[model samples]
Structures are given as C-alpha cells and as structure tokens.
Target: MSETAARAGWVEITCEGELREVVGGPNRHAAHKTRTALHALDRAWLAHSPLCFIATSDGDGSCDVSPKGDPPGFVKVLDDTTLAIPDRPGNKRVDGFTNILRNPRVGLAFLLPGRGDTLRVNGRARIVRQAPFLDGMTVRGHRPALALVVEVEEVFHHCAKAFLRSGTWDPDTWAPQALPSRARIAKALDRPDDTLEFLEEYYGPGYAERLYG
Candidate 1:
C-alpha cells in the first residue's frame, strides 16, 4: 500500500446524484423531457427497427438480456403508451420473459443496422393472451405462445456510439462463420432433427409471416 497517497485522500467519492452529458458537448439550453420526447408508439422508430435487446431482472437481482430480432414493426404498438411483443419460440429457458412476471421493470434497446441513432424504451411489462391481440398474430397457423405487453415509462433515442463501438453495422466485424448453426447447436444438445430444423427455419421466415402479417 502507498501510505503517503492514502493519507492524502486522493480517492474521494462525493456520492452526489448528477446528470452529466459530456459526450454530446455543452448544452447552451437544457431541454426538459416533453411528450414528444417521450414517445409511446412512434411509427418511425418501429418502422426502422428490426432488432432490440430486452433486459429484465428477477426479484433477487439476477438478470438476463435477450436479443429480439424480426422484421421491422414486428413489435406491435397497441396504443400511444403500450406495445405488444409476441413471445416467439426459442430454446425454452424463457428467462427474460419469466423475469418480467416477477418484476415488471424492463429496458428495451431497439437497433437498426446501418443507422446511427437507436430507440431506447424503458418500461414495465405484463404478459397477456386475449382475443384481439391473440388474433392479431399467428405462427404457421399456430398462435403465439404468449405476448409481453409493455407500458412505456420513458422513451428516447441515443446516438451511434454504441453501434460504432460494437461495429454492429460493419459486415467485417460479424461473428465468424464457424460459429455453431442451429442444426449444429441442436446436435450438441442432442435434440431431434425434426424439431431443430423446424425451429431453425421458423426463426426467420416463419417468424416474419407469423408475427408481422
């Protein structure tokens, strides 16, 4: 230990709450949040976004972030302040969806490839299965297992730094081809071929026609 530096109190934390916006440069005028800024169902954002990440945590604070991707507008805007996202088939852990059952607090980050700005939605969610909503979506004639209904708390657009840092829009930065395919992934799990192939194919086209139609 550096006794001299420790005695000087160099590592001091004020622990004060503050809003810092250093990256966007100094604001001559502070812009307070407005209804326009806090959009519920902005068609433009949904139209551009084909992917989003959903973050949820359980009562114990254990967390899961699931990557959700489909055609643009796959997430249906039920009203000015609510969104209906179909619970598509997957590996069946249902971690994120289940977490929301215990704790409604959730964070959604909507992403559009090749675009700089992205939509961020923070909200509380509830699971629902009903007539209009249930009838609104289907998968290969089969209906959605369930749907997550999100009550918008706050919504905003963030700059491109996240995409730039992740190189999400760059084809060269993509994951290597040797990464496991669904068939290969399923093989590793020892699941049957019929189920795996159906799921693999269902993930894209099946998903589009199912939810977006």
Candidate 2:
C-alpha cells in the first residue's frame, strides 16, 4: 500500500476506549434494548409499514442492506414469533438473501409515511421458497418465488430524533423535483446506451404488474 494509505490506516480506532473518547457513549435508555417475540404495538406498527430496510452480514463478515417495500401489510405476521416478507422482483442482486443463507442474523427497520418514529426488528431469518408460502404472498396474481421467514429475537420502537431534526415526514421540507431517469444516472456513469424512455416504461405505473414472482 502507498505510504499515505498505510499512514491513514494507523489512525483508525483500534478499541472501544479510543472510539468512546472520540464519541461519547449513549444515554442509559439508549443502551437498553427491548427483546420480545412480538409486542402488540409492534404488530400494529408492522401492519401499516409499507417500507423497510434490512441489514445482514455474510459469514466472512461482509455486510449488505436491502430495501423492501410493497403495499401496507405486505409483511405478514405468521405468529408472535415470526414474520413473512415476500421477496418482490427487483434487479435480482439478492444480496440480503445470499447473506441470510450464510449468516441468519438480520436487522430490520420499518418505516411508515408521516410517522417520525420507526419500528425495529432484529432476528434470525431464513429464505422460504415453498409453494404454500410463496402463493400466500401473491400480489396481482404474481406469487413470489421466495419469501423471508424472520424469527423475532428483539423488537423495539426507535425514537424519532433523526427524523424530527430532518423533517423527513414534512412535505414543506422537501424540494420540488421529478424523479431522476435511469438514463441520466447511466450518463453519469459514462454509459450512453441506457435510454430514458426504456427506464420510464419499465418503472411507470404499469410496473406494479411486474412485481410478482
């Protein structure tokens, strides 16, 4: 490695004491984590959450996070201890699923529009491709080929300090702009072959029909 790169690495925090010195520890309540199969409040929160981000780590310690969103209640409560999230069609990278296969531990954060607080779920997860499970998650006649079965290990509600400071749920705080076309994004990457029309057609209103297995 270059001298600068090697010198940069030497400045990294090597232990908790060094890290805590730079950034102080959390408050007492912040350190207290809630653990439950599923509380009633958690069930209600999950029922209305249409978006969630899940983080997982591979066996070799590599990490990946994937966003999953569908209609409200897309993630079903199988029981107090379990949750079922349909694997919707996407770019098919499957990073989250692949990570779960190697390391079952996952951290999930569910968000509902207009709500400042978020629901957090941490658990062990497994990918299920059984017909029965897949068929149950069918949307518009499109059944998912796979679903994630998450066994709840810890469930809690995260406070809205970050959202409150950022005004995430406030429309007035948002800047007016249209969604960026994939062509524009491709151009930024020096790829000229991706067309705006193709991206528009692929992600337009009718794109909902393609969200099946």
Candidate 3:
C-alpha cells in the first residue's frame, strides 16, 4: 500500500460533534464545576499541595510541561484570583518560562501524595524576578531567584478516576526498579563522556546536599 493509503485505515475525529459522540458529554455538575476565582476549599487544597505540573506553549504552539515541587504549601495563594509558584534550582532549561514569555497562557495540575484527585488551574502567567513575596518563599535559607505568578482565569477540582485506574497511590503497584537507575540512564543517554562510576557518585546520597546550591 502507498503511504497515504496505509494511513487512511486510521479513523480520526476532527470536530467536537464527532469527539463527543465517542466519549459522550459531561453531566451538569461536571460541566459546571469550573470557577473563575479560588474558593476556600481551593485555597486549602493549594496549601496542602507539595507538587504541581505547569504546562505552557510558545507562540508557535510548541509545548512544554514541567514539574515544580517543594515542602507542602510551597505555592502561595496571593488572592482570590492569583497564585505564585517559586522557581527553584533545576536543570536551567527554563523551557516553560521561555514559553510563558512568548505566550502567557498556562495550565497547572496540583497533586498531593496519596491523593487520587487533583486541583486544576488555567491562567495567564508572568515571570517575576524581584518581589517582596520571594523573601517569604525562602526555604533552608535559600530564597528563590524568581517566581511565576498566575492570574487565575479558571479553576476546578478534577476527578480521581485517572489516578484510581492507574493505582497511583497504591504502594504495592510501584516498581521503580523496573527501569535503570538515574545515574545509569544519565551515563547512557545524556553524559556519554562521563564514566559510569562518576555519574553514580554525582547522583548519590550526597547529591541531596547540593539541592539548594
């Protein structure tokens, strides 16, 4: 078969009607759960959340999703319609931040350990390098150099079906050793020039000491 002919065997739904026909529409409560500003319950959830994933896309629609995490309550609730997430030490790629500069729209999903549900927020984001709030975001005497402030446009509580189906919080379902260790993978793919022994040492127990440095 020709390449185009072979691809014709796959069926794709390109319109809302076709897509909805397959999955069905959400019920009234599911369809109307979104809120434009944070509620008291939402604030409580954010206070207890230690991690979240931020999703962004550049002007050209190129995308990136990055994870941000810290001790519980790391994300600050600035107001009913605003939130601030501290930027911590990481690989320095800043792919999401770059995308935010090009396109302010962003989405976030906040997760709590052992919880099946998540809090979702969609908003406009701006990168702030200097702010009085940055001082209060400090941890272990290390203050963040920047933060991403989000003006919440929509916020909602997502259902836990995805997590429940995946057994995410079930300890018995975990198999972390099913894959190679971080050091071994880094040596194999990212740092081919470095010796395996060196990479292992670099990602060893002492690695935690450099987390704030």
TM-score per model over all chains: 0.69, 0.84, 0.96
Q: Which candidate number has the best TM-score?
A: 3
Instruction: Report clash pairs, candidate 3.
Output: none
Give the Å error, residue 101, model 2.
Answer: 1.3
In the range 80-166, model 1's lDDT, one tens digit per residue, is 778778777666898997898899999988877798777878889998866487666664565776888888887766778877898
Error of 1 at 31 (Å): 7.0
Q: What are the per-residue Cα lDDT tens digits for candidate 3 across 59-166?
A: 999999999999999999999999999999999999999999999999999999989999999999999999999999999889999999999999999989999999
Worst 10 residues of 1 by lDDT: 28-37
Residue 58's lDDT within candidate 2 is 98
After TM-score superposition, the amount by which residue 6's alpha carbon in candidate 1 deviates from its true location, in angstroms, is: 19
Give per-residue lDDT, candidate 2, residue 140. 79
lDDT of each: 0.75, 0.86, 0.96
Q: Evaluate model 3: give its TM-score.
A: 0.96
Task: Show where candidate 3 strays beyond 4 Å.
Answer: 1-8
Candidate 2 C-alpha lDDT tens digits along 116-143 = 8999999999998884666667787878
Candidate 1, residue 153: CA error in Å? 0.7
